[model samples]
Target chain A: MASIELKDIVKIYKDRKRGTELLSIDNVSFSVDSNEFLCLLGPSGCGKSTLLNMIAGFESATSGTVSVGGKPVLGPGADRGMVFQQATLMPWLPVWENIAFSLKLAGKGAEERRAAAQPFIDMVKLTGFENHYPAELSGGMAQRVGIARALLLNFSVILMDEPFAALDAQTKLEMQEELVAIWQRHQGTVVFVTHSVDEALVLGSQIAVMTHRPGRIRELIKLDLPRPRDSTSAEFNEYKRHILALIREESALARADAATV
Target chain B: MNWLASLREQRDRLWVPVLLIVAWEIFSRSGWLPPSLLPAPSTVCRTWADWVFSIDESSQANAGRWIHDALASSVRVFVGYAIAVVSGVLLGVAIGWWRWVEKTIEPTIQMLRPVPPVSWIPLAIIWFGIANKPAIFLVFLGAFFPVLMNAIHGVKTVDRNLIRAAAMMGGREAQILRYVVLPAALPSIFAGLRIAIGSAWMLTVTAEMVAVKSGLGYVLWDSYYFLRYDLVIAAMISIGLLGFLTDWLIKLLMSRILHWQHGQTVQGRNH
Candidate 1:
């Protein structure tokens, strides 16, 4: 059974400034079961982020439906936690305060917010830096704060849009390991979007490959490989090779379409 | 050593004033101009001390009356500026947030903004009479627009993603405005406030010269009529000193509230 569902979703953006229409998502449809880590793999112009936005209720589908826990989404709610490309932590808030921001909006007392934020702070491995402001933090540290802020919400589904795309490779690898460990403990559905094939193979329980501009799903592949998946493993390389070919074909097709225009 | 370092910093700040004073004093004593026409810094200092302390009542009418005049001007600036701060911020939030509010109110305000505050003297005098009321009205006129313009900019330019993040966190519209938009808009609001306070002091003095008669401006004008140029210079110094102090007080308050901005702002970098 699906924990999250998207049915024939279409998103058309009206570019009023350009006096044109942009078809960002073209009838894309998919779902994830509870506790499934689904990586949305796509090129830069693909609608993977748009699909995630619709599921997060930060955007509306032009057609069809998005349902979480069998209930249709009308708009953004506390039930869906989003980790954006940038940390997007309020500059005014320190790490602990940012992690507890949802509780603050709920009118929780300062002591309660402080107490509640502690576990997630530890989950993100940012225990001693609770008082540091966002500007004072490194990019990876700031992204950890962003993740903790979402984790404290305890949503059944977490949506991440290339959250660690800005991190250095070493930090990214460490963060990916920490994320999978946290997910194992939390046991929630996650829809992670990234253009990185290695990232998809490393983290995803299922990978959904999307085509470029006016995006539609190209393929959906499930991973049954064991935990702590090695990138150099034959199974991992096979999945990476298949995904790379799919994306390369999609990009080449897009370029051909552009040349014709 | 710490005191010496701080003193060196102070000397770097004070050099221009010291040089200007020395040049003025030398020129005055050179018999290059009539001493009566342009009083030396020493003479002005003496009159200022007399005005402040009533030492031998040398200032005659204004002797030891410095505090009263300073307080009077401060009261006018405070009241008028308070009114401007409230109305400007409120109206600005409305204008920036809602299209209806912007359409209905913004054009008239933009039109009125260009008219000089001093030009409102006749209307202010008629409406408020020749007292603090008229003076305060002018100060309000001067301070309101800058605060309003800045508040609008602050609200309009708030990052869209913050509002989205708040919404995702269960914030309703009012809560989003209160928790997210207001905090995001605060730095810009402080910028507007700092500018408006300077305008507040300017209008207060200009109003004192015409509509009101008990502040530093009144003393300056009165001393000029009596040919007491030393007293005139002393009153000028008083206005300058008070203006500087008020602005510095606002800066102190701004820095305290905006402490989070320390690492992110240009001013913070300077510090």
Candidate 2:
């Protein structure tokens, strides 16, 4: 059975002033098996994040259903851990406390929460800076804390919504490498949202390319690159070129539609 | 460069006060204004010493009464401010977090807010009588709105993504509110508390002047009846100093609690 499933999902947002509905996601369907790293890659406003949010249970689909581990998702719960676009760590909480927030909410006592959070903190390589507040950390360090927070939840499925989009280029590359290494070691299902074709190729086992607004899955391409895939390799280039062409085609079609309007 | 450095020192900040005192003394001795209306700063100092020390009964019924009166005013301010803080935060968080609560309570509260707390003095006197109760009631009235407004703003303005992140972690509603919402709203709540403290002091003194008779305000008014301008000035200074002290205390508490926000300080580090 698939670890996660999105069956004919649709999301419509009401434009109250205009009395018209904005269709965000249209009949999107996909499934992820256990230990699959699936990247949802598209241009901005392609509803990739919306799809991720539905899986995370942050947003409800207008129609259709999302299931995790064969159980339907009712609302946000411990079964699916999510890392947001921004590092939304509690500013008042220390690094360890933020990482252990899920356990804290579960009413685990301080010692247990602290104990459970340690491995994940080490997983993210943020061991010594456990007591530092979010404000005291740099942007890259904050995102690491965010990753640790998600990992400590011990959920079978992890959803990341542009988690490294705010970081500097060098930091983004480092985080991508770290993320892949973590995913490899942990072996869990992941649905990552991104606009970068290179990022999707670097990190994903399967890439789900999506079209512009009223978003639908354009294609789901399976990648056969070996572990520690080289970005400069011919195979990687070929995949990148294909995804780039798909995105350009969508953008040109969107522009043509806009010109007619 | 050395002169500029010296000019920027703390001692330089005191020059104006010293110069003002000297000018006041010269003018008082010059006798352009009646001493009964405008006493010298030295005379005010002498009366203040006697009010505190009671060495010669210079203040008559109010001699050695400084401690008692100041304590009474501080107690009223503390009690009222405490009540405001607790209730304001609870109600504010409720109104901010829940749409139903906001729709039901917020408009009424906002309508009542613009009506000055001072206008409620007659009602306070009639309901609580001329005692600590009236003074405290007035202080509560004055302090409550600021705390409420700020708390509401803080809670309402909390990053939506943070709540989403918390909810995504399997936190129940109560857990999300207590663990996520409360801490995120604290900085704004503290801002409200600071503003409320200032109002607390102001209302306490105002209430003492009319409704009660045992604070620095009472002493100032009573000294006016006896034509002791020096004592009146001394009482005014005492109120000002006490107000400054309480505000400083609140600021100290704020800094200790919000030490996590230290790195973003604009002026850099403190010595």
Clashes found in each candidate (C-alpha, N, C closer than 3 A): 0, 0
TM-score of chain B of 2: 0.94
Question: Considering just chain B, what TM-score does every model have?
Answer: 0.96, 0.94
Positional deviation of B189 in candidate 1, in angstroms? 1.2
lDDT of 2 at B211: 92
Per-residue lDDT tens digits for candidate 2, residues A171-195, read 9999999999998887899999999
Chain A TM-score for each of the predictions: 0.96, 0.97
Report fnat for all candidates as fractions from 0 to 1: 0.81, 0.92
The DockQ-derived docking category for candidate 2 is high
True contacts kept of 2: 0.92
Model 2 segments more than 4 A misplaced: B1-9, B265-271
Q: Pick the lDDT winner.
A: 1
iRMS of candidate 2, one decimal?
0.9
What TM-score, computed on C-alpha atoms, does each candidate reach?
A: 0.97, 0.95
